[model samples]
Target: MTEDNGGWIVFQRRFDGSTDFYRNWTAYTNGFGDIDAEFYLGNQIIFEITKDENVELRVDLVDKTGESGYAKYSYFSISGPEDFYRLYVNGYSGNAGDSLMYHSGQRFTTFDEDNDLLASNNCAEMYHGAWWYQSCHHSNLNGEYGNDDYGSGPNWYHWRGHYYALNSTRMMIRVRRY
Candidate 1:
């Protein structure tokens, strides 16, 4: 419900058996904040928690499937942060091929044209044309080099300007607090 230091977001829900079965309540982050925690109910009214102790957000899904279909269950969760976390599906009981697909965690930060092309301990830089030695430095771009041409680098870059020029091979850079 709140964003503290732009760090965390929380969501919660409770059911008092006021609605009918077969209804579903889905939640999504809208690509705004990182997910810190989660919980859900099993078919047999079991309580389940899905999140590490130190996450930033928590989601809970209470499955109150009354005399409905065969309790068909499906859920999806994702996070965007600096580090990576393991993905668990179907109570971590199903095989990888049978369970839903999970993607690697992504970290995103605002593009700083002044810092994008400059090399630093956290970023790398590459040139598209001419191989200008000064342009190859990391700290020059301030971490915002999207192209190889002049007037502020390319229109699209990735991995902190590690790659350049090619349409599809651009790097996908992300930012996170140190």
Candidate 2:
């Protein structure tokens, strides 16, 4: 949660490569890892929380060089399992750049579930992580921790290149104020 900013609940956090984000669909649906270290707070829970509210999504990122940036969306939400938990994010405002907008309306994809737009490829299997991939992605937060080999690493492409590994990342959400 934020101390000075709004009450943001951090649902996804990664650092130190303690937890593996390259997981199957079930693992992503139910979520995995400890909240204090690294974790993804289940897609189901996220859908439940954001479905009825005008929520804001914030992604804070720190590169390997210690440079920090953030991406904030005024309206963010996702659909249920029937829809593959399709992403819906808009009203971008932040320093990290609007990388997520490219994925808006895209369905989430895991190694076991090929819901991405690319018909000939499994983005999750190729990228080493699951995400709301639109022909792959512009941001890959849930990826190979601290390893950029084969373009598999936690990265926000608008902030850093695809081959650069990030130092830390956090995805948070809160009810929009106005």
Candidate 3:
């Protein structure tokens, strides 16, 4: 396993039906790197891909901890892979309910599960990013992860520091990217 100068971590499998990460025979990266691409799993995701194309890999986050820290916001944000970029959330997609999509305001709410995640304070909206912000579990006025003494939220109005702190409101965006 080796790290390229551009910070792209790649993993490949030498044989099928192999689960030994060290023996799977592959490459790796290390140190400071740009998180250009990643995914938003409702839990933690730490794995390497070795020689595969379009295979459905599933990760479950049933009451997981460590990397996820608190279990509020989105859940998890990863900085790897390629072609995955800035996330845009949409809350208005569901009806009056605690839909993971509606409350959390995420584009991809779930990952190969029976249902998506519910309202997340850690990874909620654009403020949380792929990883959680600094401070507390609740995003503050500065859009950081803290109380900031303002309130514990039900906070709406994603202004400068606040990305999606609306009043339990749903956000729907329709912008084309290239």
- Tens digits of lDDT, candidate 3, 1-178: 1111122222111111112111100112221222222111122122122112111211111111212111112232223334121122232211122222222222221112111233344332333222222222232211222222242322222221222222211111111112
Off by over 4 Å in 3: 1-41, 44-131, 136-149, 156-165, 169-177
lDDT of 3: 0.22
- Tell me the spans in candidate 1 whose CA falls farther than 4 Å from its real position: 1-103, 111-146, 149-164, 168-178
Where's the lowest-lDDT run of ten residues in candidate 3?
A: 61-70
* Candidate 2 overall lDDT versus native: 0.90
Give each model's clash number: 26, 0, 20
lDDT of each: 0.22, 0.90, 0.22
* Model 2 C-alpha lDDT per residue in residues 1-178, reported as the tens digit of each score: 8632769988899979989999999888898999889999999989998999999999999987888899999999999999998999999999988889999999999999999999899999898999999888898899889788655888888888788878999999999886
Error of 2 at 175 (Å): 0.5
What is the descending lDDT order?
Answer: 2, 1, 3
Q: What's the candidate order when arranged by decreasing TM-score?
A: 2, 3, 1
lDDT per residue for candidate 1 within 58-80, as digits (tens), equals 22221123211111013323232
Q: Identify the leading candidate in terms of lDDT.
A: 2
Model 3, residue 138: distance off in Å is 9.1
Which wins on lDDT, candidate 2 or candidate 3?
A: 2
